[model samples]
Target: MARSKKYFNPFKPSAGAEPPRIIGRDQVVLDFVGALEGGVGAPARLMRVTGPRGSGKTVLLTDLGSRAQDIGWNVVNITAGINMLDDLIHELSPDSSVDSLSVAGNAAIASGEAVMKVKHPNLRALMKRCCGKSKGLVITIDEVQDAPIEAMQLIAGSVQHLIREKKDISLVFAGLPMGVMDLINGKALTFLRRAQSEELDFISLIEVRLSFRDGFAVSGLILRDEQLEMMARATAGYAYLIQLIGYYVWRFADLHRARSMEVSDEDVRLGIENAMTRFHEVVHEPAISRVTKGAMEYLVAMAQEGERASTADVAKRMGREPKATSSFRRSLIQREVIQSPVRGYVEFSVPFLREYVLENADELLDRY
Candidate 1:
């Protein structure tokens, strides 16, 4: 007899990859749809989504874009970078007109006639023409923090201009908290300051449990309530981690079945351990690497404390003045690496980060 193939992994571990079902964020999705239906000048049309690395900001943007497309609206999705503005203009430009432009150079258009000149098409004019055909245009920019200020300003200016002209246009930006704050504080993009901001927070444990249960049922697996809760708690409501846990646990159960053995708590425990390792390697390590040396020192000191660290205690541990420590604290909080639960106490925003830091303390502290 041939052995059955391993159970298919339904969960997606890739960044920005949409899952079979979005567990949380139902209200935000609804609000976005409402804004699209509301037409021009809706407050929800302009939004900034901020979150940590695994908080699903990109996925949320994709979800919103999909909804917009379903209603016959044009959606332009771009990642923020040096060429973001150019890409946006190209995407919005008339297909035939854009095709006439050379790959090595831009063509100038005057009196509806093309001339050989490297120039960007007027986004405002292109958008106006687009609005004539489609219901509206939704521009979704991911990784907003990485884009240059000039690029951001250009996109924001065009969106603001179109909005004032009563054109059906919407803009959604997704980035880290610090980047979002910088964009808001830019004098040229003051309009974005008034835009709706959605900070992606941890999903509720109850919802996490329910999603797992439903996902397992669809995969022909039976997960007891206790097992579902255990999986949810292990993920701590982090979106990416939730998928990781489910993927590994499903594989574990499949392996047990292949061996003619019942899936037990041991399989769950092993799966949780595997998921934790991947989270540290994929999310925690990369996130910490980008932080400033002083900020990392502060984080290392917090890890040493093994729990929430107070401003006074961390300052003392770092042997730095409280004022100096405060600066690092604010930066980390803005990055969503840590959060202040109370007046002066700070802890890692994601569960198990402290343990990850402790395990890799030497490697992490070496940079500082």
Candidate 2:
């Protein structure tokens, strides 16, 4: 028999990069495919795949799209967050009735409108007819939450019309938590309710309070249970943090030709330190406006303390009463620098933000 090759991975998730095949999300993929196959009731399904940043949303969507193609369904992917539908429509098929189904059906749909108009009519009609057939069509929207309200409304309207017409079409939207919230609040709610909303919950690592364990485990990067736990604790289950640690450990192991099966505590420590250096570079490199910087610093402080800070507390920390702090806080929240968990509790949601802040608290405070 041929010798078994050693496949060691450091960075657990290859989001932008394509994987040979999906591993862990088998059930999720099956559920999505089943919906596409009309395995339940309607072949048309809308699912919002959500998780924290770097939680493998893009990878999952890409894999699902590939799977959809393998089964003969035409797949149309639009990065709604980046471009509006008008831009997308113009890019896909120019010089055609925007709603003619045949304009979107040509084999070279990715190209000109002549073949598309003859084959597929409009985007909505083409997608509906394609989805109705044995070869279903799927549309996936990446970073869907950041999509403008107008785009969201337009997509929702299309989906609603399609469903009402009982056409065969399905959609998968992936984005940060905000994207899900936006859909629920907007006119999309009518469509969203009929669709399954799956929150890609983070891998729970209680000891490290993070999901690194699953990250390494799924990547086939074996580590001693204790060592893995330590690493998990340090990173607190953050997707990027886990990948950062894994990247370092794999690099160090490969460089030193050390044991591959079990990563050591020392290895974990070194990896974290290296990640911290990279984090520090990014955090300190940009000197934004004073107000933005001050608000960020204050939020960082709250994260380090592991407690939510009220507007009043935030004001006090920055040596400004509620008024100035309130204005700055609103901007920060809008920028996703801080989030309100409930009514009064404002907290930082980014992973390892506390540790980064504690390390540079003195310097950050000085700036303010």
Candidate 3:
């Protein structure tokens, strides 16, 4: 009913927070529309997106759900964890609740679902009813990596059954690249294996530049073309980094430059430094914590080298023979932590991961 007051930070850096304008993701939205309009059994109806942390998987799902809502579709978005199946059922249930349904952190379910009734139903039954009540039904799951296997199986199986019966439904989900593969490859999720899969990565630098221009103009914050280019390059085309840099830059201009709202070259520098500090905490630590000790050693060894880490050199650094390190290399590749650019060399797949490893290698190498 009312708009919030404007804040200096025009960028929304928090995960899943929709930015004023989504950039470089036109194809995803286009494909979603195509799939939605194409009806059941459309390859895009069952879409799975995979990406490393901070690569905008959640944001993409949020965008798609909003688009579906705009077009008379009943969109239900849920995160994968705990009682995710129950949560989905609750949303589709009458009154957005069933006396028997179990959910957590969903107080607004009743207000949002706009439903009325007292009976709880199974996923298939509830979804079919929801589909019947809407022009179309869209169920989007985020962080699919953490989805309980049995719940995921049930959801997938229900969607599969619904599809066979020709109910207008769509199932789109996103997760880290590694976990998505593991989930789909599980025993009961064979249907997921055939879904249209997408891997998100860096967006174009030009798009980031344009976004920066628009975000800056909103607050009358000015950066010359050269300075804007420098700031854009520092982001390396990562979506989170773009938000972080813009947020910090805005903050610095807001607090430090009270007299002038303009952004200077030095502001970009300090902003990036602070942004990286936040990035390390929010993105790097959790990501690296999940890597195995042996993989850390391999990554640390690779980080020790400036660029294009040679297998032989990495093995030497890890105090292992070249042949003995192949497993670690393959493991990292499969997990999308690293990539083999050339036959003999590897590199970090995520931007600045190598730098982070190098800066903290003494503590990271071989750490459990």
Q: lDDT (CA) for every model shown?
A: 0.80, 0.60, 0.82
List model 2 lDDT by residue over 1-368, tens digit each.
97755556635434455444433466788887777777334533688887766566787888888888888777777786545565445534555334432212212212222222233255455456556665655778888777775555555556666666676666788877775676657643455545566666554566232244555565455567777666666555554455666677655544444345455667777887886566445432232234456576666556554656776676666677677667666766655556788876687655555566666667666775
Q: What TM-score do all the candidates reach, one by one?
A: 0.86, 0.73, 0.85
Q: How would you encode candidate 1's per-residue C-alpha lDDT over 204-289 as one tens digit per residue? A: 99999989887777767778788888999988899999988988887787775754444468778988889888998898877676
Top candidate (lDDT) = 3
Per-model RMSD to reference: 5.3, 6.8, 6.7
Candidate 1 residue 117 C-alpha distance from true site, Å: 9.1
Better of 1 and 2 by TM-score: 1
Question: What are the per-model numbers of colliding residue pairs?
Answer: 0, 21, 1
Better of 1 and 2 by lDDT: 1
Better of 2 and 3 by TM-score: 3
Look at candidate 1 and give me any clashing residue pairs: none
lDDT of 3 by residue, 137-218 (tens): 9999998989877677667777877888899999999998878988888765677888887888688999999899889888
Sort every candidate by lDDT, greatest first. Answer: 3, 1, 2
Candidate 3 whole-model C-alpha lDDT, 0 to 1: 0.82
Q: Name the TM-score of candidate 3.
A: 0.85
When summed lDDT is taken over every stretch of 10 residues in candidate 2, the lowest stretch is 101-110
TM-score, model 2 to reference: 0.73
Candidate 1 whole-model C-alpha lDDT, 0 to 1:
0.80
